[model samples]
Target: MAIDDSLATGQRSLGDPAHDYPLWPPLTSGCPRTSTEDVSYPVEVDYAYDKADPAALFSPVRARGGLERWAPLLPPLPAPGLGEGATPLVEIEPGVYVKDESRNPTWSHKDRLNRCTTSAAVGVGAPGIAVASSGNHGASAAAYAARAGLPCVVFTGPDTPPAVDAFLNAYGAVVLPVPWEARWPLLRLVVERLGLHPVSNLTTTHTGHAYGPEGYKTVAYEIFQDVGVPSAVFVPTGYGELLFGVWKGFEELRRLGLADRVPRVFACESAASGALHRAFAEGAPAAHVTVGASEAYSIASPVSGYRGVLAVRASGGRALLVDDRQLADAQGELARAGLWTELSAAAGLAGLRSLGGQAPEDGPVVCVSTSSGFKDKGMGTHRTAPATPTWEEVERRLRAAGIAG
Candidate 1:
């Protein structure tokens, strides 16, 4: 399928919109004018919203071919795709739904971001792609890079999940397991010395690729299409790209006069490293915290980004932190509801449950489940002992388990 031409005008700094730059060579280092030693800001793509036609862009009969359908509102998409968008919105309770993103090509929401980031790499005519990730991001980047026929280098922590490690190898990516703090620096070296395009964050505070989150905005568009504008959206936030993207998508709807208002967006983070939460509490644009032990490895981010702060603040929402216990409980709840998600992906539901009686009463609320349970650490380590083949033993075991035949 032929990808549609992008209507993206240019790029603008999230910290200072007055400082604009060309669409090519995305400001990966962020706005040089507004970024500082303490905190760094990310850049966002500017689309020709006034020129967009609601009837054509939001047509119910639009063919489904991933992010390409929304090309006019997205950055240049030169790279090929694996059908990344069009996830399902499953209702788990009355007026409460879960945006199941694990159905994507890589079984994670990062597929949406990588599809755009990889396209940026292709658009810029870079040699290859490099990234620093814990699991999902690396796997998604590797898949996209391979699809684009570009060499990929993945810098991951020594504790990288087995499933993700296998994914990197399967995609023919050069995998380097280093110390947690060394990933970003190594990624920078790969970009500078090797001339490979970086699809991950390279800054001190996490201003990821300019085109990455633009891919994520499709999540909101799909949600809006499935079930009008939700009252609120809870997202599993690490660097806050997904949260900001979802909020921006809805904001665009309202801006285009399609929707009356934008939903309140919430950031759900692991309490072990509540960088966004601390940033909000301290009234800072971004902040860094010493990360503690947490089972929700995917969302246990140590730093907050300006994009997330902007999304929450502009939407009049708050950043909420959930402990590992709450995350596990949420995971169990989802599994019982027939949706097995990564522990970190459950943070959205965990955050909402944290609200208890204070949950939103206006309209339907959505909790975005970012990845599948298969992406979790130590996913297949446990081995269940085989039961005895004898009928007596099976009957006894079944009876003990309340499954008598």
Candidate 2:
């Protein structure tokens, strides 16, 4: 149980049960990766990798109340749920399963990021929190900020999801509906002046702030516990944080000997943008392009991240671009599975289906469903019922609809 001798150096080791995870490459690269001025730029997060095994992450001596194993350098925040681990590893087929992240507190996996990002807000002593999102991340940040009693502000797009919008409002976040292009500058101004924390990725590149992915690593933790290691994981890629986080989690699990091997990290993106799709093939870190429109708006991004490339390469995975029609079909299949998720959420399922459903069974097939179907603001599915409600009238209606109760 000794620390990897090579990994040992000037680390403040807690032989009792704790350790810090570093974020930078070795200093011997002859590049002082971290400098205080980088606090202005912050190239390498002031963090380090730990010798702690993945299985020991929840041990009391190593954990904060046995929930989160504090990021060796990342800030602390509210731990959502009762450790938020043990989320349902639901079976979709004999071996395939969907990690229904929608069941999380805000009905999406963003809770994991929120838990970590909000912790950053607390750690940095931000007066408040802010984000440019009209979806799960916005609502999640608001709720987490409220839980932490930090003031929260959210810059939403005009087309922001109604369910998520209402959640932000309910949490009393200062919700500002701004145009998409205006978000980053506005966030910059706000952060410079008001000192509010920005949770979403400000970098046109998609590195999403440091702490958000820290929380998202929990998804991998849960998956490993459920099935040990899967043949592959299909993630609904948006900013690519969740994709990279899940990949990193699984990778860390393997490093810790908790899981046997790595799963194929599938980056499922909407065909509208295909940033990850193109970047992966080009063998580059990340790339930027113009975003085309699609029903999977959550993932319609022209830019991807460096971490995304690392995830795919490290796991021997592929980047998948799914069309809108295929996405619709995937949503239907999931509905049949009794999992009602949004079109973007179904993107992962679509990628799996495109794989011919012949995925191997190293453990379980996980499709990272990102959000609820209620997130589809353009959904006109809900309509007023027809007139009349008597037993005979309902019977006649059911007959016309080919339903019998």
Per-residue lDDT over 1-405 for candidate 1, one digit per residue giving the tens place of the 0 to 100 score: 343478888899999999999998877888889999887889999987888988788877636648888888999888999988888899998889999999999999999999999998998899999999999999999999999999999999999988889989999999999999898888899999989999888888879899999999999999998888999999999999999999999999999888999999999999999999999999999999999999899988889899999999999988999999999999999999999999999999999999881346688999999999999896999897788899998898889888995
- Sequence-dependent TM-score of model 1: 0.97
Q: Predict model 1's lDDT versus the native.
A: 0.91
Candidate with best TM-score: 1
Lowest lDDT sum, 10 consecutive residues, model 1, at: 1-10
Per-residue lDDT tens digits of candidate 2, residues 83-195? 43345777888888898888777777888778766766765667888788868788888888888888887888988867667778999999999888898799878877987
Best-fitting candidate, measured by lDDT? 1
In order, candidate lDDTs are 0.91, 0.70
Off by over 4 Å in 2: 1-75, 78-85, 361-363, 379-381, 390-405
Deviation from truth (RMSD, Å), model 1: 1.5
Off by over 4 Å in 1: 1-4, 357-359
